[model samples]
Target: MEAARLAPEDVLPASEGITPAWPGRSVAVDGANIHVRDTPGRSATVEPAVYVHGLGGSSLNWTDLAGLLADYLDGQAIDLPGFGRSDPARSYTVTAFADRVIRWIEHSDRGPVHLFGNSLGGAVAVCVAGTRPELLRSLTLVSPAMPFLDPRRSFHGRLLPLLLIPRADWLAARRLAAIDPADLARMVIESCFADPSRFPEQRFAEAVEEARLRYTVPEYTSAYVRTLRSLILSFVRAYLPGSASLWQVARRISTPTLVIGGQRDMLVDVRVAAQVARTIPDSRLLTLHDVGHVAQMEAPRMVARAVLGMLSEASSVKLVPRTGASERPKRARRNTKSKRDIPFGGGITPAGEAAG
Candidate 1:
């Protein structure tokens, strides 16, 4: 028997008066909490931009990019359901993640704004575009984890499969906490950055601190476990050879898209970067050399450019690339003339380059 199919409207309920407007606060939706941070652009006409972080990551991951893009329009970022300062969701799935995003879209003061996501967040963005095209102006994905287990060119991510077991969570959680600061720091330096030398010491400290804080939470173990289970199940279902893959949804996405990845991404193979571009009819790819899994961290300007480009395209605006993208004004009134661009590329462009 087939699993189930959900309509766009069925998944996204109208969340009127449900989610509050908070620049850097938590909001409730569908009984689940999500962290939201909004920055108004310089212009009243430009639409708002929504940013989503990956698994175990919060809206904080997008802080640098969000601040720059928010300057482009009414800008924003989210913690998804479970990972950040906000409380975990009652249920979790790619569809559920999409639902939270859609409901937020329905509730926003800005209509059909630009949507940006990274890794897991990238997958959610794709699902939202496929499931509810009407709610999106464009899509910008940063090293989205849409590809299945590529036995070659990947290792640490193999850790995800072990997630099928509950015990693994305990061990992983324990290990995360018990590891020496120097060793943990080494992992961060190796896994997170293309140039470990450049990372600000305080910033890395905050990430480690946040990870430590999560380790102390009671639900942290279970939430991480269930989150892993969901991924394993989704992966199994999406990769049944003859069945649909995440790329299947990408193909049906009518919205314009920009897909990007880092040359040094170890978790999700950068090879899948072009898959999104090939599958999404109107998509592009930007692969930055010497970067890692966290594009927003390693290259915020590049991520911002892709998002702002897509937003401009969706709003039908003729944009001046590079520097102008940084100038997006705050939320005001919609201008009939131009919009922000949606640029998620599959190949490496400079930090903020636009393609034809």
Candidate 2:
């Protein structure tokens, strides 16, 4: 679980005002322009990992974690359609998003990849693994947006209650557009972090500026609304022909999987992580106490260590057995150490002890 020592040249400063430190370049995927963070210097033998961000998040979200793993993994993070610099597609369905990722992987001709996703992206990764397991070598999900009835834990859960009326999205967009960017940024940080202080000041300022820029885009609000609607629809589409419930899809996945959850996560309930781990037959769960919704952003070193640890043991990592309805996942012992390298199996033990 040691953090990779990123060299001075390997690290890029946070971009002026808007962009985060991650390096991005536009590339077409599934006939749509995709802005991706393509980190350099991966060994030829190591399998590349593709990162997918959550709703409203761009590939820039993966910057710190991607850099930490760059030595061991050829990492690239995608700005899903309608997010980041990518143009919104006509359809923003979860399946459509998953298909684009699958197509991109296929186009790379790099064979199966180690896929990592956060929140909404995690759910999308599950779709990809269930439908096209052949394209993935492994799967890592951080607080995936699994179906939950609790409004406190899900955007759809809350949105559904208000969207029974027509044009709800249109109305929601107008309200969202009225929010000041700086206020919106602070709100996001409050919602996502267990301790807002964990985020660096420079990055926070950049994020606020980025939020301001996003608010000014003519298509951003509509894109946000459309994507949010699609996300909600995916959870209830089990009745659709050829569609499967997230639980059902989880059962169909054979790829090695890692599920990470933050105990204090406000968005995706941490208790749900155990169910997700149990449902995905070949999966392991790591629950970090006191961490929030965005563990990668709030606890990048721990995430980097867990992911690298998972990759290092890709062939031998054993899956935890499905727990009973009341059984809970093991919680890791919290650590208070600052950013530094630890051993390969640093944070998590073979017995599911979570490192703080």
Candidate 3:
């Protein structure tokens, strides 16, 4: 039996209503309530894929890309504990989060999913893929928060370490409290994208609404701060050998992998994208010129196309070269004239030397 393929219109209807095609539900798995955005695929027998969002993000982050790729994959995007609608966990750590995902995969009886993650989730996905290779068919990471010692590349890179300070949560909450949800949304868009103007207004509005709603959650600030601290800690541990090392995890991963990075990302360094690609065996790196940290949000169709291509290709693993960027998907390059050479903030160009 073969899987049914989906078209973009099926998931991305032209309507302007709030829900659109992607809808989410809370599911109890392994004693944890996980918020998963559900999008039915073209066929029932098709294999399932799961998406994990970055720190402070929810399943909503995967909406556009998941919708765009729904034609080819029966997808679900998980909001890690303490994010979205999920209940808070006793402890928040990359390993703990990855364990929750692994347990869900095992409990759901969903074998070897096409795993997708961005930023912190990407780091968790790497841990999962490296530790339990049996649970994944393929892995896709969009700006995975791999280790980079230089803090100058991004504001978050510099800020992450400081989050370990005493009462960092209170400080962060105080900082966030002064900004309106809409303004916060704009700041996030500006920080995450090469060109904030490219973001869809409808989606932008939804994001603002979500931001407003998110503020109401009592655990929001604590979760954000704690997760940021844990993520920074993960970067520190990534240098060590054995299970603690993300590099070790990358090297141990046997599954085929696809890594995506943006040239103008203001969070994770773009150069880390290529470094991660080189670390994982049988993986390829795709660098989107003039794009930002959140490539899936910035260019959904393009990201979806890249994901679908990686999934559709033969299962055989191959070594992609470390030099130069992976070719941009043809569909993504159509409107080159509209894209500007956006400048990166917080001196994020050190990776540019590595990229060269």
Alpha carbon lDDT of each predicted model = 0.65, 0.71, 0.74
State every prediction's TM-score relative to the real structure: 0.78, 0.80, 0.82
Candidate 1 accuracy as TM-score: 0.78
Number of the top-ranking candidate, with lDDT as the measure: 3
- What are the per-model C-alpha RMSD values against the true structure? 10.2, 9.8, 8.4
How many backbone clashes does every candidate have?
A: 34, 7, 1
Q: How much is 135 displaced in model 2, in angstroms?
A: 1.1
Model 1: which ten-residue window has the lowest total lDDT? 1-10
Which digits, one per residue and each the tens of the lDDT, describe model 1 over residues 182-224?
A: 5665675576666665455545665676666676676665666
lDDT of 2 at 308: 56
Better of 2 and 3 by lDDT: 3
* Residue-level lDDT tens digits of model 2 in 1-356: 22111122212222112223766788876577988888653334446789999888888778777765654567789888888888778888788889888877887776588898899899989999999988888998998987665566653356666556677666866777889888888888888887776666666766787788786666776676777777777666643555477767878999888888888888786777777887887777777776788888776766765665566566532222222312322223223332222222333323335422
Q: Global lDDT for candidate 3?
A: 0.74
- Supply the global lDDT for candidate 2: 0.71
